[model samples]
Target: MTDPERELNFAREIIGQRGFRDVPTDEVLGEAERLLNGWMAGDFRMERPKLYDHYALLLLALLQKNRDLEARIEALEARDA
Candidate 1:
């Protein structure tokens, strides 16, 4: 299972990209929390979107994971430098 906090963060990132313009950070964060909670409880099912939507979600997850890995790598490199 994925870390809950990580899943929440991922949901927030995805929604933010979907456009929550001018919305308060707290509101967005709350939405992410709600979504994460629903998903964890298996109450977040929805109709499938276009193929692009699926791909976009996958790519976002991959990019976020890559970014996290890159940051860790950079930190290690600096420590060893």
Candidate 2:
């Protein structure tokens, strides 16, 4: 499968294993950042480069979603207060 496809599958697996509200976004983002930086700096070598791309994209998406959710929650709280 292509990198995007693989990343989507990985996301689905993660959500399936841990419900959407329970996902460990912080941990996943941390690992993705470490792997991507290591790959870019030549400190790590992988037989498949696509995996790095996949995780990088996934990390960005997850971060954006987390931020969006947090903003929505803050807005709701402010409205209630």
Candidate 3:
């Protein structure tokens, strides 16, 4: 598979293994920052920079979605209580 596809598949595997509902927002943001920093530092020697950028963006989007779901859950719980 291509680099972007590989990266996305790896991310999916990690999220699936850990269960996305159990993953904290900070952890997701940290992963995104790590990816961005690695890209900035030229850590991926063979992959193009844009690939990492896309990966970072994907993580950020996931983070936002996670936060939104957390908020909704909290609201539902509070309403039920």
Best-matching candidate per TM-score: 2
Candidate 1 lDDT, tens digit per residue, 31-60? 545655676686554223432243454454
Q: Is candidate 1 or candidate 3 better by lDDT?
A: 3
lDDT top scorer: 2
Give the C-alpha miss distance for residue 73 in model 2, angstroms.
5.9
lDDT tens per residue, model 2, 6-77: 323333333456655565666556655665565567665544645644565466658777898999999999
lDDT of each: 0.53, 0.58, 0.57
Candidate order, TM-score descending = 2, 3, 1
Per-prediction CA RMSD (Å): 9.2, 8.1, 7.7
Off by over 4 Å in 3: 1-48
Sort order, lDDT high to low: 2, 3, 1
Worst 10 residues of 3 by lDDT: 1-10
lDDT of 2 at 49: 43
Total clashing pairs for each candidate = 0, 0, 0
2 against 3, candidate with superior lDDT: 2
